[model samples]
Target: MDDDVERAARKVRDVEQAVSEHVTRGGPVTGRASSPDGAVTVVATPGGPPQSVEVSAAALRMGPHGLAAEIMRIADRAQRNANTRLHQTLERVVDPRELTAMGIERGTDDDESGWRR
Candidate 1:
């Protein structure tokens, strides 16, 4: 029992260190996308809404409705991209079994709870 406790504590410490490294140096895992006509671009970070958006002068001519649609489309793509990157990062820092225990499948975009589930 003592050995088991020691092992578990070691695992926890390792996980904590890995998480710290990820946060301090791994950088933000982001996803990015652009409009079909290349007039708009969007970037998203894990567990958050879009972090940045860029619209070219030509995109302004798209008007309200067109611009809205394009933005939505690009935002969706960016979110998916961010999710993928976030998962990859997590895989590197977290134990696969722990993620599985939490019902987080590898490569799945179902992390609607900001990196939870």
Candidate 2:
């Protein structure tokens, strides 16, 4: 029992080390979004950068409705791009099992989680 625990601990430690080193391997991905009129801009860095932005009516050359739609489109694209990068980066160093051991679960409860190795 003690040996089993020790083995698990070691494995966890190794995974942690890999994650730490992996993150340092590259810079964060950054993205920019703008309103339809090119007036309002949103800057985002999903993995490392932000919860920061401002919106203003001054951005609306086509008026408020168009500006709002543009903002949504831009933000969604940025979010998807960030997610893609994050997923790829995570795949490089940590498997789902490692994430489960670290209490980082993904996917729906019905779907299950973790990797084989």
Candidate 3:
């Protein structure tokens, strides 16, 4: 019984350390997205602020409100991409059964984003 308890504790510690390192790494996984009009682009990583935002001169023609809206849309797409990548990365390090138990699972053919909760 004591041996089982010790093994479980060690497993928990190892998982915690892996998570910490992954978060601090900033990005081995990244996502990039661009507006359909090529006006705005965004690069992001999961759980982090956007890594970069590029606004082309063409975006100025949209006026301030339209440009803001486009940026928001592109940013959301970029974040979703990052989230999918992050999910894949986590799957490699964490147990698939554990992720399923948490109600996080990969998407099916109907969804390519690779994550659902």
Taken over the whole model, the C-alpha lDDT of each candidate is 0.72, 0.55, 0.72
* Candidate 2 residue 115 C-alpha distance from true site, Å: 27
lDDT of 2 at 76: 54
Model 2's alpha-carbon lDDT is: 0.55
lDDT of 1 at 58: 98
Q: Write the per-residue lDDT of candidate 3 for residues 1-117, one digit (tens) a residue.
A: 999999999998998789668756744676677876679988876667888899999789999999999988888777677666666667867987786565444433232342222
Per-residue C-alpha lDDT of model 2 across residues 1-117, encoded as one tens digit per residue: 999999999988997787667766665444455554556555555444434445665664557787677767666555444544555566767775654454433423221121111
Number of the candidate with higher TM-score, 1 or 2: 1
Output the lDDT of residue 31, model 2: 47
In the range 1-117, model 1's lDDT, one tens digit per residue, is: 999999999998998788778866867667777875778888876557888889999999999999999999888777776766666667887876776565443455543322311
Worst 10 residues of 2 by lDDT: 108-117
- Candidate 2 is scored at a TM of 0.49
- The stretch of ten residues in a row with the least summed lDDT in candidate 1 is 108-117
- lDDT measured at residue 39 in model 2 versus the true structure, 0 to 100: 61
